[model samples]
Target chain A: MRVLGVDPGLTRCGVGVVEGVPGRPCTLVAYYVVYTDPADELPLRLLHLDTELTRLVAEHRPESVAVERVFSQHNVRTVMGTAQASAVAVLAGARAGLPVQTYTPSEVKAAITGSGQADKAQMMAMVTRLLRLAEPPRPADAADALALAICHIWRGGTRARIAAAADAVRQRTAASRTGARPGAPGRPGPKRQGGTR
Target chain B: MRVLGVDPGLTRCGVGVVEGVPGRPCTLVAYYVVYTDPADELPLRLLHLDTELTRLVAEHRPESVAVERVFSQHNVRTVMGTAQASAVAVLAGARAGLPVQTYTPSEVKAAITGSGQADKAQMMAMVTRLLRLAEPPRPADAADALALAICHIWRGGTRARIAAAADAVRQRTAASRTGARPGAPGRPGPKRQGGTR
Candidate 1:
């Protein structure tokens, strides 16, 4: 599955695209950091971010998108910008009919580095090793974006499997009640459920 | 000038449009509370807001837009939504090429009422009295939106006057230096220095 991950911010929004499934090495497709001028009016800055994100989505056409879920624990002024930028990213994915997911910083860290409390250096080291890059992605935001993409691929794969398993169980139960073969395909259920994280 | 004021929220976004100058009694053009299902995904909710605001701007063709500036001191979760929604509203106005301004809650209250510490009921009462509405706009959100519009008009008028005065002084200074008559409109300067609040 091709996935796009966004580490959203008004000043520096990082975007990374990766292709892979769960339990497999993910391939890095591309990475970018979108920048907006702080001196610009808020609306124009947001508009610029929106335009870039929409263009990126059009270019990459990822099957799904993942964004870092912003929390209010951060510096109040910065968090608002982060939330606004994330909104644009989420809207870009949803407008394109792609499933969009958001993971907390801790969740992304735990998924990439095996610990939610891992520091930035540790996470960067893991992201470098996992993606088999020549060097660590420069400008922390880029690495964070890649990490979010990796986390989503792994977690989304597990969620998909669990959903499929639950669907199988339900199908089997329904078949037994109808006195039909358990292996037989009765009807197709929802393809996927609960895309948000 | 026609102004659209937005009290942005994920579930209930209030929009109000009015037409008038700074000191004159404003005339209400229209008012609405755009609703999005709270159960909807965050991206979907933002998309709904963007779509509605875009349509409103297109239909009304307002000269400018005003949105309430979201602060972080409010309920954390609710504040995030407010920031996101305000971002969408700002984007809509910017995309339509309208000047967009944001005012803090206190600023709006102070502009509408005599004091910034005024409560909602007092602000609504002023809004009703100022607009000469038959009744106070329904829902606190609606009244708040109208207040924002009114605030923008009054404050924007003051800002414009200040800008014009500054421009006039600069022109007179330049005229004296260049041996040209003052107020001759020599080499027309840029109009409207700033659009943001």
Candidate 2:
């Protein structure tokens, strides 16, 4: 499975992608950032973000999108800008029909480093270490984005899904021995396809 | 020059890229809609978007990124989503080291149809006609992203800059004959340089 991770920011949005199944190490595919001038009017800034995001989505074609959830910040303007940039991300994912998932900063950090309070540099190092990347992903934002996606795959149960799917098949065989057909009206809850997901 | 326009949204983000010099109607290098599941948490969603955007930017290598400016909408939730998505875009461009530009929805509409209030369908039609695409861009949102890029290129003064630069050269020639040097302490006002913006 392929996952795209984003770190939302109005002035600078970070993006990263990793492709792989869970339990196994994730493959680092790409990472980058988008920058806009806050000095510009809000609408224009959003528009610029939208256009670039759209282009990027079309080009990458990921199966799913992952983004950072905004926690409240002290600055009103900063929060507002962050919120607006995040919208552009959701918009991009939806427009492309890619399943989008978001994780809070703490969650991503915890999943990657076994700690939720990891600082930006710590998160980056963990991302590089966890993914076994060639280097610490340049531009901390991009690494954060990568960490977020890897964290989602880590959380989303890629490995468990596979195991569960196999167990589901095994259960179906056992049911078939007793003459129950798959999806046969009330036949023990449809055997949970796609694995306990 | 290829310019990518993006319309950032949490539900649907639009992407379109026009490849050509200013004044020359651009070709739609690519277009698509990105979608994310509504139930996902915001951070995971952002991560997903970031990953996808990085790949796209790397693939397209657009010289300039054009995106829509966010607007104040009545619904707070809706506005919040839009804002978040927009931030992802800003981050994407910055990471790529590409110059990013923004336009208002009204600015895009006005450029395409001579009206700031042009509807989506109208903008799509005009964009298709202007860009000379094989067909109207899909998902309406993608068309919007494309239109935003076109609008910026049309009015971005890229071509105008070329002309302005030529005129500056002419003025400098004339001034030199009369002994006026730009960027140097002069008999009149402060001298200007023709080189660098």
Worst lDDT 10-window in candidate 1 chain B: B188-197
Q: How close is candidate 1 to the true structure, as a TM-score?
A: 0.87
lDDT of each: 0.89, 0.76
Q: Candidate 2 residues A57-166, lDDT tens each?
A: 78878888888887554255477777777777776786687777778888998888889898887887778777787789888888889988898888887556767788
Query: Candidate 2 chain B: worst 10 consecutive residues by lDDT?
Result: B182-191
Cα TM-score per model:
0.87, 0.52
| Steric overlap count per candidate | 0, 99
Q: State the local distance difference test value for candidate 1.
A: 0.89
Worst 10 residues of 1 chain A by lDDT: A188-197
DockQ for the candidates, in order: 0.66, 0.20
B1-197: candidate 1 lDDT, tens digit per residue: 89999999989999999988987789999999999999988878888898899999999999999999998888987889888899899999988988899999999988888698999789988999989998999988888898999999999888888887877777666556555545554665434433333
Regions more than 4 Å wrong, model 1: A172-197, B166-197
Cα lDDT tens digits for candidate 2, B4-117? 788988778888878765666777788767776679766556666666766778888988788787765425557666766766776677668777777888888998899999
Q: Could you tell me the lDDT of residue B175 within candidate 1? A: 53
lDDT of 1 at A125: 93
